[model samples]
Target chain A: MPKLDTAVVGLDIGGTSTRATVLTLTGQRLGSGRAGGGNPTSHGAERAAVELLTALREALSDFDPARVVAGTIGLAGAGRLLADPAGRAAFDQAWQDAGLRCPYAVHGDALVAYASGTAAPDGTVLIAGTGAITAQVRDLRLDRIADGHGWLLGDAGSGFWLGREAVRRLLADLDAGRTPGTLATAVLTELLGSAEIASRPRATVDATIQAVTRRAPVELARLAPLVVDAATHGEPVATALITEAAAHLAESVGRIRAAGAVTPVVLGGGLLTADTPLAAAVRVEIARQWPDAPLRTAGDGAAAAAWLAARDLPEVTDPAALHARLFPAP
Target chain B: MPKLDTAVVGLDIGGTSTRATVLTLTGQRLGSGRAGGGNPTSHGAERAAVELLTALREALSDFDPARVVAGTIGLAGAGRLLADPAGRAAFDQAWQDAGLRCPYAVHGDALVAYASGTAAPDGTVLIAGTGAITAQVRDLRLDRIADGHGWLLGDAGSGFWLGREAVRRLLADLDAGRTPGTLATAVLTELLGSAEIASRPRATVDATIQAVTRRAPVELARLAPLVVDAATHGEPVATALITEAAAHLAESVGRIRAAGAVTPVVLGGGLLTADTPLAAAVRVEIARQWPDAPLRTAGDGAAAAAWLAARDLPEVTDPAALHARLFPAP
Candidate 1:
């Protein structure tokens, strides 16, 4: 099979959604596509792999898929896929279906996010999305990870945790027959309804609980941004939740790092990527521990995946140009 | 509609199990039976009602259903039942099926547990079982509750919380490539078969996590006993978990109590009932806060409900004898 020297593919598979990109080896964008959640760990491996292929197919429609020289896929909970033969078969089947004869490797999302953020291969990546996890990279290999316990057990600084805390405060206020603060009021309004729940706080609390219990527990994460919005408006309870979340995230990084190492700390996930108070507080908290450490937000993971794939190629290419293209100034 | 002066019925509908008991007005136990869970909040109201009736029928098989006079039912999260029309209909259907002629009222389990434990009408009940919750009571009515947020949100100090903490420590130890402690070792053995998981710590950790993720999140409570056993064997991680659990439970009680009030503090639920270190530590913590407050363990809630029903009757009775009959030694 002859390779198309100009073509490469990159993918970022997450719990919520998956994105795929096709670009030239010389950093010219060719195609991009998106599909539903493709985290094999959250969704089944077979479904995730099919979704990944769906996105890749859409992205490679303009080019020959077989011509792509290399490809990389980053996913959370990738261990489950690797641990099962059926799961591995799903990946192979997806690759074959996409008509890709090129070589590709699957990597943990934490590693790819770190690679996307900084050129340094020995730093850390802290992600606080629906779930929270921190990983340490020593010379580009993931050395250790901490606190990605999912919503049921841990994910201390994650969206689910914050939202759950907000509802708990609201319920407590309702039980105590006290007027809810700005944070609780906003949370209840979003959870129950606009007008009917306004007067009956206890009923609102009951309905909120009933709703969450009847649905998926992960759906509670949807309420997290409202909490952030309340905090931005100076709600003390919301502010306290943000402070605690930052502390938890910082603690996760501290648990993996040694004393006085000037490692680059890369932040990823929607909570940190948004220009919000929680994001700013997390940055401040990280700086408190490593006074001189550089902080960076991750570029598009799909682009980083391409860079990862292209890094092993036998040609010299400008990595900085790819970074500039993927993460253009806003 | 004739009431049986000699017979009274009581029922406890819970998330995991439903129990019913028939007793004479003088506290002579006639029959008792247990069936599947009947918590309308966890299971839908229709199923809960059916299960409740099934338990009652089994207990009442030896007696006339119409003879079950002055019945009382204790249900957890009963508000959900009250709010839904179909749920209310299920309750009505069960009542009609049972042929009850006497007055009956459904009360929250927290209130019934308080009545079961102490002679005083105003006090508190701290329950730490599959879940953890504390309620303040005044004159037999529930005043307020704390920390009953279910496994997904709160329930801090619960069996699920302890189990979750154990697995977390196990994962951390596995990630750090450290030797398994007593707690981790026991948890792995229970989650995976002992013979297969004994040697490979990393595989065991992965298997443990994979197994938990596949099941209902609340099933984490099944692992709590292993942690308690490890703590008893002096594993530092397990010991720390139990201590934290005690602190959380005590804090819940503190949230509801008044300063310098000599109110009784009743303890309920399996974790507190068992002669474990958690229960002992909770007693010590409670004593520290309320030096003069009496500490009591609740008798069977079904018996308490029956007693509550019988208390209003014109016939005088020996309360001490009834308590002794319900919670006999061993």
Candidate 2:
């Protein structure tokens, strides 16, 4: 087994899922894998760490572990760094890259999104995925990002927000004398699998109200894709939700712009970069907000950033030489 | 004790607090008390009923059960009815409320707010107290109300929304190169005591997370007063949130109007009718949306409804007599 020298691992931890990648000296991916469940920050960092380690082991089943040198993780949560001097320091390692025994770097997953999404170490990046966020980078200082507060409080332009809004509109339909069997209701039935959980159930008579309540949001968020699909079919509520999300994303960009960022914005995340009406709505809104600004895909941005980060290794002396090997610059 | 023929008892149950009021048919208050902890809806109706009955007995301290001829309850998480119907229907005469053997009438606490705040029954009412809701009463159907989907998914234009939005904005400010010691931060500190709950010696991470998470909307709701206060002091964020809430409320009214309901509107609840900028904002927005629509307070409306409900009660011999007794014709 070749002794790994100067390899850096990057891990991205999101609320719905976690992903880890092992990058070789030349920025080539040695291994990668994904795991299910929620953010470990809410679930305890140690438990999350073990889950992540298990995931990494599974991802790198074919790779020799002795070849890896350093690891860093980007996670979503209250992103106050645990190692920082002022932090209460509840979370030391990223939930996706947990149980690190070596010198490891950890930052908010938004930072990783920013780093990998923008393809530049210093630039403004907006992540609009299952959740949405905007971050600014200048002189290695991250500043002025918007809308990454998570599902409970804030997360404007997120899939979760968009999905939930669709549910609200559906309820409004019931109130507005519209038929109950609209797109939203159908979406809900498919998600919750019972009318008892969807509509205003007689909660007082039910002993299983908690069981009903627990499934509510999941029922609601599941309606998001239906909303997107409905918008494609010209449903007003679906269109409104997507449009509202786009407007929010635009407002976030405006906030980043207000914070004195000059770099071209990188838009990354599942909801935004997907080939859907939401992505189209976002692009249109962004164009209206800033006509000339470039909006890049998160995948390209992440892969580019990963390739770029790998160039920092002493083994990869020339960036262009390595970039060609990993990805051909368009 | 003499066997009493007619009397009134009131039960108020909140998510974290409970109160009971005893009264006579003449509306004379008899005894009132409060209890700690959340609603039984979260716990399971049977368990909650036991707790409520136990608490009521502890608070009542009375020997006579025959004096209670009728009982009315106001509870949170009860949906449209305040009684634990599932428990009662399941256990028959096992519950203490059944032991009293009184005819019972149950309604949402929102109805209590309406009774306490409105002047008529036939109107639309907006209540923004600990939780916020806008209810429209068109004839006999109490249809088309908004807000109160719990603290997580929805509750726009409510105090909870305001508080949560404020926190998110403060966090955004931190990410934007600003510190976290804003007036919002001060309010949070005053509310939660400190930001280092995760580091507390006896803290469990999920519990702490849930505490903070659950408190976000409540905290946002707390921002309602702060926004009103800040408007008095002339702060931008405070003013904006209130104004935004007003707009959202106006949009709601517009939707109501679009649904072809030309009814009188009522504004009640702690947040809306409070001595704050919200009253002015709401009035302005509503007037802008529905220029000629009648708007009034909900206290009379609730009293009128309660009066009406009382008149139709099987115990009432003459409807006119009850109406004239509860409400004199102007």
Candidate 3:
């Protein structure tokens, strides 16, 4: 089921989750593993390193780790990890603990995200998952970036922003003593734990506030999917949030493109994946804003990391064909 | 010496800090005390109660606690405290711990902030301190509110919003590999602890992120002052943030006013305090949006609580004179 020593490891460490894969030098998938959030920016380096190494160890269990010739790990806020002595030390120790025998490359998520979407070295890439940010890829490297300010200060079109706006609209309606609209109803159902709590508006409102304040603020991103569901059910407030999210994403792209040429723009991250309502709205808005620019949806970021790692292997002379083989239709 | 029996204890519990004052029925300030944040929504009811009681007890120490005729405390998100059993227990215990002898009342900050300004029984009160919210006060009670949505979902023009925007602007500049603008420079200095770190852009960026990530998200509000300084120095990005803050505040006011008759609108909270850039912009925008609405700046929220407490005392008549004496010309 799996092969070793003829592959490379590709890993994606995100704010909310971590994923890893082993791929043959010719881009054949060998094995894969998934784990909880391992972003050192939020989880601290020790925990992040442990989670990351665990994911890698699990993926390699079916194969010999010694056979892996190269590896690449893509993560956001990696600069913070590299800057901290303990953070860097923990990462080094994690590799040692995992018993990896390979040349490892650690790159920021921005780099891998760009590669995940397009073969071009120059273009724009936008990600709108738990957080949102846009970067210009020039000569296969991340250049100027827009937003990505994290949960507190920015991330305008992020899942966190969408989810927060949904709760806000719900609370505003409850405060007005208005009958629950579909969006508010759905949001409350999810946030307060049941539709039965609807009759007790004050208690519901109070409980919602207490519950939200009790958890990490970033966890609000988990609520973004509810907004999408409401919008699909024709909730005006949810529709408006999607519209605003698209506008914010478009503006971020505009800011990035203002300083450089428009090669092609790639959209990435969970919030803007596939045919989701948010993604559809973003596509429409992006067209209106930049009709001449080419737009594409990114493949799996973790897969992209593996492809990037495998492309440089001696046997992988035709990286594009290898990528096609690894990522078959559908 | 301050008068006894005639005195009242009034407390203002904020997300960032707490303050308390003892006032005579005549509305003369007797003593005051301050402590760290005591908002149950942010710090949990136990910590909030401890801080609130500590501040109140500190203010009561100068005079016999038995002499207090009335006591009032105003805080945001108080509904959460009153609704949760543990939260309520904490408050009751805190009162016993403080040994306050008077019949005490706890009201939302909206009520006290309204009383802090004009004598109008119906109008509006907008606070934009550590958090932002606007309320329509009818008959001296908060009838309806707009955007008091806590740090997680709202508080758009708050200190937290301002501070977050500052750091975001800094990161944008760093991402562009451009020399720091005044706003970025000021933000980096305040956030990273030194402007000298600017010489090493990567380290500076990494350190700033580490510092921000290491602290609680809401603590971003502490960086608000740096934004003001940059705006004062004519930084365009900082100016834009102030302008946006003003718009958000004004829109919140509009939301509250839309549901009620036009009456006096009083602005409170740290960001909207007299003469701040945001305050001035809000005034300009508010005047343009509602030319006939009366506008005033609220006196200290704690002082308002004391004044409101004094007004309710049987011996206290002529509340206008009492408020005049308590707030003076400041």
Candidate 4:
């Protein structure tokens, strides 16, 4: 079962961090490394490339780079970055500097996330973290998508959407002279930095509104976890918000999914990957929509990337077994 | 009922422009002037005061300022401006420089909008222009308000809300590979500067999204009129948007309105004051909720301010009759 001195490398470039892992063809861990954000869309191409190189070098420190049979990279904003000449050049330079002789494949982050959940080549992936989007994946590539329009226009069932609804509900209660519910009170305390402000309804409402609008709109996503916490405690407002979010997310998947087809459904992103009320609610909603579909939560992305690299190698005959070894059921 | 020498001065300070009018006690217009924005919330207190003085001087150019007995100013952000010492000092200095010895009163813009519709001392005023807010007025002063939380948090049923919904629907259609409807096509032409981009669905969707997000988020309000126009031509998507907007606006009113109360209801702002489908839908919704409430559209704000100035004078015995003479029946 052991591979003789043959290894593979994988990288996951995200907006917040870059992760790299080196693994044997049999899924044994060789080395791993982490670095700052390497997404060219947020950080410039040059800096992203440099960070990518830093993570890659660290991961390959204890392994022989020459023995690597294959490599794979999962990148956010892959299309935008690869389409630009400068971005492509920076990435090429990084790969060359790593002294890797093996051929490598690059894929969109969504596809890699789908691979992280299951070995299925055709399925759907729904991500509902800070933003929300659903995509239909065929042969491990994104084929169609819905509702990834970001926080400004869409992202209907996202963390940002939940947070905004919490604040709006608080404002409505204050305006109506009714006491805010537990969830709204928690949101006010979090945003205004104190629960004492709740005594003065009018002034507190005005200050809370100002406090939220003054900052970046996306920062509202920070309150999503609080919503989940309150819902876990049986808060009605938060429970309702979670239900609505689940419905919206299910609708997004329904838009791209085939009717009466029970394909695999992979749930990614922080909201779905975590063991939260929203995750459970989404599972129920998706099951109601497609009862026969197999639901899976995404695992470690770097490990998944490594598995993808090893899957196509001549030595790895059973890709599904390799995938199961890499990401066992929780 | 002509007054020999008494006159009144009124100023309406808004975010876009400032207007001042001099009127005789008998509701006859003596002189009027207009200038740039004088809302201290947008323009600083110093510049707002300067503009106010300029408009006052121009309005009094043909009339004797000494004969003006009372003055009234309806200002946006009245509370914030008056609460700050710097803002108060600026307005005081400007008032002293204007050569008026008469006393004056300051009221929130909502009150002035209510007065523009009816002479009733108490009512509810709903505004749904670039933003949406509903207020209860008691004795011509703001009593309570609902849903003025701005674009980021609330402002449901607003122009910005309608515009955002239109863009979101277009994106949804594009993501689902469905041909966009007339309303979405019009919005695309407006944002992308041409409909030719529609030939390339994927690239055009990406470009259109980038174009809208790259600018100020509030600029989405510019697309509201397009939704209304399309709905006028019997577009289903636009008609649905208008219906939802009307429902939201009516719901906002219902939040603060007293059940079965028949006090006057004044509808202000561009969406309600104008003759449009949204206006008709809103009227129908509001009437269904409160069948006996008299619904009226707001008229010239400056004239309303002038009438407010003359409302409590010794010579003006009948204020309601004067208001009718000033605004008249539309």
For lDDT, the strongest prediction is 4
| Interface RMSD values, listed in order for every candidate | 2.7, 5.6, 2.9, 1.1
Q: What RMSD does model 4 have?
A: 2.0
Number of the top-ranking candidate, with TM-score as the measure: 4
- What is the TM-score (0 to 1) of candidate 2? 0.70
Q: Write the per-residue lDDT of candidate 2 for residues A1-330, one digit (tens) a residue.
A: 232444555666666666767777666677776775435556556555555665576656767554555666566663534633333233333322443444555566666655554445466677776667777766444665565666765567787787677656555554454564456565556545654442543231131223335674434454567777888888776787788888887776676575443456666777766788888998887766667666665553323434544645566677556545654533
Supply candidate 1's per-residue lDDT for A83.
81
Report the lDDT tens digits of candidate 1 across residue range B70-163. 7888999766677799988888788778666666778899888888887567899999999998989987888777768777766889999998
What is the Å distance of residue A119 in model 1 from its true position? 1.7
Docking class of 1: acceptable
What lDDT tens digits, residue by residue, belong to model 3 across residues B129-189? 8888888888778887777677776788899888877887776666556678877777777
Q: How much of the real interface does each model capture, measured as fnat?
A: 0.31, 0.38, 0.45, 0.81
Report how closely model 2 matches the true complex, as a DockQ value.
0.26
Candidate 3: residue B118 lDDT (0-100): 77
TM-score of each: 0.81, 0.70, 0.77, 0.96
Model 4 chain A is weakest, by summed lDDT over 10 consecutive residues, at A193-202
Model 1: chain A TM-score against the true structure: 0.91
Colliding residue pairs in candidate 4: none
Candidate 3 per-residue C-alpha lDDT over A39-147 given as tens digits, one digit per residue, 9 for 90 to 100: 8987999999988888888888888887888888889876677789998888888777777777777778988888787766688999898889998889777776777
TM-score of chain B of 2: 0.69
DockQ, per-model, please? 0.30, 0.26, 0.34, 0.76
